[model samples]
Target: MMAMENLKQFLVLLSGAAVFGIVSIVFVLTWVLHFREGLAWDGGAAEFNWHPVLIVSGFIFLQGTAIIIYRLPWTWKCSKLVMKLIHAGLNLLAFVFAIVAMVAVFDFHNGANIPNMYSLHSWLGLTVVVLYGLQLVLGIGMYLIPVTPASWRAAFMPVHVYSGLLLFTSVIAVALMGITEKLIFALQNPKYKDSPPEAAFVNVLGLFLAVFGALILWIATRTSWKRPSDQILHTLHTNGGSEDNTKVSPAMSQLSGGMDAEEAGEVRRRNNKFDDNTN
Candidate 1:
């Protein structure tokens, strides 16, 4: 009953996050296509429009989804290796979107004879992107590489989790700053203080981004929603253990102590294979 209740709550939060993420993408698109010149690659303001659009869709939305992929109940049946690959793929795609968005901004600035990276938004935004890339590389090395030690992976799990969430939150904050900066520079006649329709619209977009980020953070931080250890699952399957009996078998527990779920899963698989070969 408790498991069912937790599943329900997880579903609710996941659905809410997905709604906010989709709405954020739609809001950004509406703002760009309706309020501003539509997208283009002519090194104009139109090209610059891609920056916010891609950032909202890929950086914030896709990246957030990737962050919480492990918490999805349906995906639990899949191997952690598969989940990691999907997670890395989503992030890689988001990174590609970010790179393209950066190019669009630089091209637009060069064409307009405007100084680049002068604003606080640009500085923080670039910093976040660079950090995100580094995080991705390190995560792949630590978690995906078979040569990596279980102890190292276990020790790095907390850092990896923390940095991912921090980067995610920072991206959203930097996005809000970028939106405000854009409004200030673009809204000369009516000014942003007057709250023109575009300003109002983009503000709502920022709100959606913030809400989406919050939902993601909430989901990621919930210990109850974490993927069950593969060792536990293996034990339950072999022993026909009840769902409530989460305690691993003695051998599995001994092998998995002090390791994170992924590392423990690796060790469990190796031990099982060794036993099978010996038999």
Candidate 2:
């Protein structure tokens, strides 16, 4: 009953996140295609339109989904390695989109003779992107590389998780600042002060972004929703092991309290085999 209730809550939050994410993308697209000059690569305002569209769709939405991918119950049965690859793939795609968006902005600025990376929004956005790239590289190196020491992976896991979430939140905040900055610069006739339709529409987009981020964060942080370790699953299946005996190794818990059952089982099997050989 409790599990069912949790599942229901998770589904509701996931659905809400999906709705907000889609709406945010639509809002950004409408803002660019309808209110602005639409997309182009001509080093003009049209090219700049791609920046917001890609950022909202690829950077913000994709990254947020990737962050919570491991928490999905349906994928819990998959090997950790497989899930890691998927997670990395999503982040890589998001990074590519972010790079393109940055290029669009830079090209637009250069063409217009406008200064670049001057505002708080630009500075923070650039910083977050760089940090996100660094985070991705480090995560791949530490987690994906089999040669990497288990102890090192365990020690770095908390930092990796925290940094990912921090980057996710920071990007959304940067995006909100970015849209507002654009509105301030773009709106002239009615002005942003008069609360034009575009201004109101974009404001709602910002609200959607905020709500989406909140839902993703909530889903990611829930301990009960975390994947169960192989040890726990094995104990439940066998109906033999004591609660204390089924507890995961300190290293495994540190690595990921919710690490995939298959991966954990494989590691334990290997360890048991080594013990037998040593004996």
Candidate 3:
């Protein structure tokens, strides 16, 4: 069972890594393309236009969600503080995205030239993508980490819930913009009267991926095990999260305080066992 669980962790980590890798490759390719010949809107008012704007915007919004969620500092007796710290640090990559989104929206006129602001926004957007891609990779790492603090279901679920909402909003905004940009761009170009197949494909695929990711995160939030005595001793109680960290028994609290997080787990397990036998 332990081996199987470990395997699951490994595979999840690998999946996250793979996603970031792909994103990196795509970012590099896009940068090259933009540098050499720019995207379809390089010359028009839409140049530095809506599609790129939308993509960057979505990324930024996702970043803000990630920050608020990741900054959660809670290490209960069941989980380690260092791990939480690492997770939080990794999560800050999302902030880069939020910054980009704001830039993308700055002084962006509906149908006129925006070369100066666009240049700045584009540069900032690219930076956000690169940094936030690392956040994705780190998420994969966090998933694989065996010794995560015990506040999993409680500590992070709410964050995930709110973040999911944010992601939905960002994606919707970006998706609409992407579709509209394509329609208008296509309309303007008599050479190609029809909307290209890829616009629909990209927009649809992005939405699908975002939805699927949210579902997976929600599913992951369905586990929590707490010591009974800890609950009895504490007057304040919520689901089970950072706030409950200090409410643990003296031994668990002391050991957690004094020992390294990984070693502290052994002490915590023993204390839990003793508490069970006493009851």
Best by TM-score: 1
Sorted by lDDT, highest first, which candidate order results? Answer: 2, 1, 3
**Model 3: per-residue Cα lDDT over 1-279, one tens digit each:** 013453366346435534543453354235325422344433343333433443433343333233323212122222434544544443454444444434434434433443343443345444444544554454444343556544543344344445544544444444444434434544444322463444444444445445444443432332211122232223223323333343333322211112334334655574575457448
Per-model TM-score versus the true fold:
0.88, 0.86, 0.42
The parts of candidate 3 lying over 4 Å away from their true place are 1-6, 9-17, 20-79, 110-187, 190-193, 204-208, 211-270, 274-279
- What TM-score does prediction 1 earn? 0.88
Task: Write candidate 1's Cα lDDT for 13-44 as tens digits.
Answer: 99999999999999999999999999999999
Indicate which candidate wins on lDDT: 2
Ranking 1 against 3 by TM-score, winner: 1
lDDT of 2 by residue, 1-279 (tens): 125666799899999999999999999999999999999999999999999999999999999999888777777556667778989999999999999999999999999999998999999999999999999999999878888877677667789989999999999999999999999999999999999999999999999999999999998887667655545444433544444333333233222323444456656774575446448
Q: Order of all candidates by TM-score, from best down to worst?
A: 1, 2, 3
Clashes of each: 0, 0, 6
Q: lDDT for model 2, please.
A: 0.83
lDDT of 3 at 236: 22
Ranked by lDDT, the better of candidates 1 and 3 is 1
Q: Which segments of model 1 are wrong by more than 4 Å? A: 241-243, 246-279
Between candidates 1 and 2, the one scoring higher on lDDT is 2
